[model samples]
Target chain A: MNQARRGRPRDAQVDERVLRTAAGLLLERGYNGLSIDEVAERAGVAKTTLYRRWPTKDHLAVAVVARLQDDDGIDDTGDIRRDLTDYMEKIADALNRMRSAGRTAGRDDRSAGVVAELVAAGARHDDIGEMGRQVYARRNALALGLIERARLRGELRADLDAAVLLDQLAGALYYRVLVTGAPVDRAYAERLVAAALDGAMNRKEIPPCP
Target chain B: MNQARRGRPRDAQVDERVLRTAAGLLLERGYNGLSIDEVAERAGVAKTTLYRRWPTKDHLAVAVVARLQDDDGIDDTGDIRRDLTDYMEKIADALNRMRSAGRTAGRDDRSAGVVAELVAAGARHDDIGEMGRQVYARRNALALGLIERARLRGELRADLDAAVLLDQLAGALYYRVLVTGAPVDRAYAERLVAAALDGAMNRKEIPPCP
Candidate 1:
């Protein structure tokens, strides 16, 4: 093993280089314009090396998004509201970045952009779909842990569904981008977190239970 | 106008026939297998007639989904919780139908199926994207009206952000289908609505608000 690895570059460094290069192409030219060959050439890596790592453009694109999600890790500050809002904003920022990919700087582009392409990529290929789900699962695990901590500390209801809470918070941002063609900014993220934390029912009056 | 309408079958009838036939093909063959030529042949309509209406396969697919959404209209029975839960269930059912399309029944299929393709179609074409947004806008209008009436009757908070609330309910379902690969069913829909309505806070104890 030592002899085989002696002359080779570090795998982590090579992966970072290729992923950064691929991400640039994906954002600059959009999904259709992101070519495997171009990413290899731009990253100054061998085509075989890139191909061995990512068999298709979809795999490479999914990897880039997975890394972006990884970078937007959860920060537990004990204040569930603020922490949740901050996490939502980070997610919103990442989504907004992808939403604006390949579009003009200031134009009101309602297109889902690379975000839709990645979702479709997950749909098209089984391995890519499994990989994407794994990334979300890991990210969600961290967020769920934060929620659980709050619940245990009496910050949240003992009966709170942590999965659904995370779903509502993150889902609103995605729903805006993919379904409503709406912009997701920090303000919107705050609103979403607030709505989810504080139920819509008027506390003074009995809720409509029928 | 009278001359242009000369006995070429009622426009509404032709539209209904075409959309129904197209939706069948889409669900049966999935997005990739849905062919305009086959739809024209199966629907017993001229290719020009279909083209004059939809223009492209993406347009036709979008129209099919729009019709499906319209058919799944809101049910406002004065009780916002039940109403929202029912609405979420409908949306979940529709998503599940599309999620299982063209796949073997009773298999553990985690794929998003045709739903993802339709979303990608919207991103690929501006007209499709606008059409989809209009469809959701009209549907959301009905839901917002329900929330407004509930608020007027003291069922909900006076200053509640109805848009954010709706986004939370509907977004969670879509987030499950598109991102998490989780099954969205009636029980889960009930849980989601319950959480959104009651919130995650332990009101007896002060929430962890900074």
Candidate 2:
């Protein structure tokens, strides 16, 4: 039970410094190379302080990634297609960045790299898994809100499954990175949004799903 | 490289016996509990023989899951929606089964379980990752073929991006299991297929994306 306790009084500056130092080491050295002792030394913090905060390397790694995801805020431009595409691109860019961590700089590696370890970290620790779900739940709520607003504006169907739609848009990027080893980018995001918004069925005289 | 070379002579009976024994241990013992020595001993095969075949515990685990996936044959019932729903259910069923591994029976655990380790296994080894991609490639080709048949029959758009469609369908399931800790089942699959087939956009006068 190495979960970080909520509402623990802490120095904001120290927290930020530790995270910055940890993130740099993670990206520069990969997950296997990340060491708590090294991070403490580099950040000029006591080892006990970092351990008390993060507990384990997995916890530290998940925190580093959770912070990155928090910055990818969704934008609303009234156009569902365009807005969704922009959001998907932000996610893809983040995934690509994480996928590049710990690999040879110019090798063009297709592996999930640190991204896979983050997912595994969730599986390994129940608290990390809960934290990850919480992180995504917050982000998903925003995306769902965007979809709900569009539905209200008559831009989408009245019965649109916003959750499933979000899953499709975000899921495809993860599927490519984690499962299929495929590339995800702006062009792919456009194609994914188009397929999801317009659908595959021939719309000529085809009635929508009941 | 820990890769099982292609065209290498293998005893079909021994492979099946070893895989069945290994699968039992994996489901009962979980990923961390799985050991190569124990598998070789329990399967009554020489340690050298098992090592020559699987090379590592991760390879053995991947092989076990790959065999399970091989049984999920896609049935082209001609209705793309119905067929896709059925295919998705099979995937969800497999995911659920793996999600329950190494946990108390009927405990309703939301973690990804062995599935997460399998994904990490691929990330840890390039050979396993390539093997995983090949497995998905074969299965995806069949699903893509099903989508292609619908498109050819005027049931879907002529310019449908089959690959993205498949990604959306399968990706959502994996995303629920791996990222969100959300439940994936038959009912959700129905909603997913419906959303993917018909789309979220209001279709009265909206032109499809070019």
Candidate 3:
């Protein structure tokens, strides 16, 4: 019920100022520290002006996260292996840029803050949770495309669901973010691709499609 | 050296009180919000006395986590597969406990605060960041024992490294946790045991060791 209504009229410059400031505070102090007052102050605007557009902190944060730059599309090189490699590298590159952006611009905390609360909010999007699935859905779409191509080429199991494979791949990245401080670097990316492409069996043969 | 030195006689009872209070605080507020004053108050002891034992918050938190009890040694029925199932089941039980515990005790900003800090500290303890790895190590140790038996029975490839196999088995669990939020339940544990026992590649035809 507290979701911010979109499309409030504003000075383009002022709207841009508010967004950039909110994004900055998210990275700096995280969700608990972010406030409407701070966003208004950072934007050098009136509190009434900020409240006129957004209804809740969750809505504001989600909007900011929704606006984050993510991988638009995977570059397909035709060769399956090379395409996967390129895809991983691009994803890895995006991940690194996000990390660095988090560190320098005080943005990472806000990004993660939104993710944690949204996910914890479960299906309750009204209370600061609408943005939870956007990033994950984007990842599944990209990876499913890769796996679907591989399945067509007879490189993977016909029975293996693209959804499952995508889950395994994205899951590793989320796991790294949550539990391990491990970087999603090119090498690790390559290893994950290898594990997905070829099961961790020591045998050189790929599993015959079921 | 801000490290506290108990200049007098070392009392094991005092150390026990310190650990118990620290553990309670850790489970409640986590590392960041947990303070020396609170721990002492909960333990019904003086702050100076708690300080004399812990010295720093990081040191105190580590000690508290380290002291928490772990499982009874695994039940190995001499079959690696069954042994792994039971072992992972124990782990699943623990994770279920933590998931609930994390949620119920989810007050205090420590969800991000403590987990982030402690995971980053990456300090070597038998129990800290080793949360996921410990369960794997125990399972792998059982698998190594199983693989050797399988080799004698002519069921395992000669070139297989037990350590690598163990990593993949556990890596699968980590993958699931990261992606699907799937519990390492009885079913998942069985799948892991099977995949590890029989290669993900149709093991009936038996791919040769690479």
Candidate 4:
């Protein structure tokens, strides 16, 4: 056990290097181009060391995404609409980045790229699916708290379902990217927030029809 | 051309049989289990004939889904909430059916199954992606028309963004099925529609703090 303890520091360093290399490769080459062999060669680590850590490329890819998503912290500035819109912008930025990753600059890149692959990977493997769900759960909890605060503060409706609100906001972005092949930018984010926050029912009285 | 047209009736029959057989297999076995060979054999058609209609299993699967979704006609009862809820229920039913397709009875089938596979297939192939977008376009046009009618009738806001509203309604359903692994049913659909149609902002007058 003591002998194994001696290698722990070196193991941590190797793990960082491998993950950095893997992230670069995944973003540069998309899911298909990310080869474990290439990652080991670039990271100056043995294949056994890489396998010992990540076990498989899918696991390694999931880790890279987890790291990439670490910076998406939600901020509650007491203005629920602005806060939610800003939050949606952050999500759109991450999704747009993932959507364009690992393709030639001039080539057609309308496809979902590595993002769709990671989603499919989650469906293909239970562990990956669980990890993806856990990631969403943590992020959603933060957003839900933000919504709850708004509701408590009388900013949002008392009967609002925070989870459903978040779902509508985030889900529209995902649906656009993954299904509709539509572009999601800050302007679109603003429109999405406005639509969700303001009810679509006619508030003004209409003139009687002839 | 006339001679080719002479085989048109038989070809249409074969197409129907292949699609029906493929849909059955897809529902029974999920995506991976719907083999082309098996579909051809079960349809009692030659392998080449099946191949001529659907070049690959993904193509066949897409055709099956397109057929499955052909009957999702939206109802215009003049009440936007009830109409949209009914529309959403239709979408949820289709998604729930796909989510549970090809799984053993009483088994845990939370995975996206065929839905995620079809999404991935769209990302993997351009033609499939086009077909998917076209299907959504047709369906969405109908829903948008319903929304437009409601807007004209003063049920919805005159300045409402119909596409955004529809996106929110449908996007939430897809997001739950594909990402959150949440159960989407009539009850959930009702809640979702209510959330979208009724704004989340607090409408009641807030009493001054003591």
Candidate 5:
């Protein structure tokens, strides 16, 4: 990290320091409170330089997400079930971290406004859309692989669509995080995955009971 | 609607015009763009009067939501699947209307920043966080009742946590509307409800290969 920071003396395209400072403030002050002058002052750069690259707060907001999302690479484990559990639990952890961070940044000031900013940022895609897609796709692919492997082993039903099923379970987490701001721990992840995979599945095609 | 449009008597403590005009403008300018003076001018009321009633723009935003929400109600089909599907589809429809309205106001920005502000108003309530919770609880309880009814009919697992299951499916709509800005229709709602109720649900209990 230090090496990367020191070695970036040549380029002046997008201000990495400004981006980092802005992200920190955003995670702290939230979307409504962020300003170009604060970011430039924090990064020791001119406001003109910041504005030249990012015309609007929306554009800079996207850039901050893009920079932070670089860490969202795919993780593969040989055991699909364990891997899936860990992957989902990690998502919960990430959410907890973000929520806590936002809280520290005064998100509690007005109906989780800071977190709402993050949600809005996640809403649309400029350049960061691809990054967000990649992160979610990796998650989906992991679930798909687990279900496929289970199917091959005669575990899951042949007809189950892992893609859609994965969404059913994962979408639950999104709700929990966004609405309730609840804890996304391993225990919760395991239960949800197990329920989604075993308990609720009805391959016998039972009728809609009256 | 026409009768109420008639001119009000002089010296009315509450200038209804300001509130009405602000609400109309909210759907037009969104939360981020609408201002206090504009609302006053539109309503032809004193700016001081507007401030006296709603201390902040956030407060007015909440009032606006309360008004609109009063105009909306849930669908009670008595069938769990159909009812939930209809309810979710209605939510998606509302989101669509809000999106269209936002576009009309913002020209290019299709966000419910206005709505989000209103939702934020319910973030913390001394009594019970009554604002957003009442809205969500009512919606949740309605769905939970449907799921419980299904369970009582022996259609779903006796041990199924219906609340979590509902969250799993409904969360998809919220995520789509809140994050992806995607159009969720009856088809999507049906698919989600089906998956939660009768699709592959167990992840840990691997079926033994014959």
Candidate 6:
């Protein structure tokens, strides 16, 4: 109640400080090292305040990621290939950042780290799972819209399944990071977009009418 | 040493019994309920014997999944569409099985279940991660060979990136099951294969020669 009485300005400041401190700690020490008490102390906020907002480390971690993802806005330049490639590269950058979190420079670590923990957190709790899915839904909706626009404009086939195409483009990045332990970079993103758009089936030329 | 002296017959029996019991427990209670002690006791094997085979529950779970995946053999009927669709369906079936593991029948539970646990297990341990990657590599290699054969026969474009094509196909299924909480099925598998094999670009017919 007293915190509420302190009002909007103070509350915003507290949230900003807490999240910044938590994000730094997470990137430095990974998921296991992100202690709420330490974050509260560093942020100059009470433990009660942090817990009242985030509830658990998983919540705090998810919040941190939500903030990071919020900055990834898709732009539609009317060119589906370039647009999709840009979008995929953005995703790859975010994944690469999280993948390299808490690890030393110049050292090779193939561990999924905080990314795996975040997925596990969603699977472990129903509310978190719902929240994570909502995040994906919101982000994916934008990409889906972009694809639909391209399809309508005759850039893509009229019969195209936009959702599946988006899934293929985004899924490849996630698969490399989560499953195959493969590297996802701009080069890979370009290749993925090309393969998906051009497709695998060879086209046969129709005979000219005499 | 004594067990080795007991010969191949007893060793095969022990492995079969242990895996069967583990799979049963896993399906009934999910990942958390699977304990090595219980599996060993139910299988009538020494705890040491179980440990010697699978060092941890994660190892046992991975082994169980490996057994499940082993039955997914790709058939090359020279028709890439049918083969790819069949392969995607098999993957969907496997994903659905793990997705439903430890949940009540007909109950709506979006939890990824044992599949999530297996992915986390791979992330947690290097050896487990390597083994999981190897499993994926082997399975994908078979599918790649199928795609390559189709390409050579002019069924597909000669310049198609088989790896990227495979990634899109398999990655979409995993993405749906693990991230979006979507239900993957045979129908969805067919759509996915169609979208992948057929390019998304709008086709423009060449003008007839005068």
Q: Pick the candidate with the highest TM-score.
A: 6
**After TM-score superposition, what is the CA distance of residue B193 in candidate 2 from its true location, in Å?**
0.3
Rank all candidate structures by their lDDT, best first, as comma-separated numbers. Answer: 2, 1, 6, 4, 5, 3
Candidate 1 Cα outliers beyond 4 Å, as residue runs: A1-9, A105-107, A205-210, B1-9, B105-107, B205-210
Q: Give DockQ per model, in order.
A: 0.56, 0.54, 0.13, 0.52, 0.30, 0.70
Report RMSD for candidate 2.
5.2
Model 6, A144-200: lDDT tens digits are 999999999999999899889988888888888788888888999999999999988
Which pairs of residues have clashing backbones in candidate 3? A27-A106
The ten-residue window of minimal lDDT in model 2 chain A covers: A1-10
Scored by Cα lDDT, where does model 4 land?
0.85
Sequence-dependent TM-score of model 6: 0.93
lDDT of 1 at B136: 94
> For each of the candidates, what fraction of the native contacts does it recover?
0.82, 0.82, 0.05, 0.65, 0.34, 0.70
lDDT of 2 by residue, B1-210 (tens): 122654433577688889999999988878888998998899899999999989999999999988888878999888898999999999999998888887874645778888899888898899999899888998998899999999999888999999999999999999999999899999999999999999889968644555
lDDT of 1 by residue, B47-163 (tens): 998888889999999999999889877877889989999989899999988988787744578889889998999998999999999999999999999999999999999999999
Better of 2 and 6 by DockQ: 6
Off by over 4 Å in 5: A1-9, A12-25, A28-47, A78-81, A102-113, A121-158, A161-163, A180-183, A199-210, B1-53, B70-78, B104-130, B201-210
Error of 5 at B163 (Å): 2.3
Where model 3 places Cα greater than 4 Å from the true spot, the runs are: A1-63, A69-71, A75-87, A98-130, A161-164, A202-210, B1-17, B20-45, B51-62, B69-88, B102-184, B191-210
lDDT of 6 by residue, B1-210 (tens): 255666687787788889989989988888999999999999899999999989999999988877768768999998999999999999988888887877774447777767777888888788888888888888888888899999999999988999999889999988887788777889999989898889788888687678
lDDT of 3 by residue, A95-120 (tens): 44433432333332212223334333
Q: List the residue pairs that clash in candidate 4.
A: B28-B102
DockQ of 6: 0.70
RMSD for each model, in Å, please?
A: 4.6, 5.2, 8.4, 4.6, 6.6, 3.6
Report chain A TM-scores, every model.
0.90, 0.90, 0.64, 0.87, 0.67, 0.91
Alpha-carbon lDDT, every model: 0.89, 0.89, 0.54, 0.85, 0.61, 0.86
Candidate 6, residue B162: how far the Cα is off, in Å: 0.5
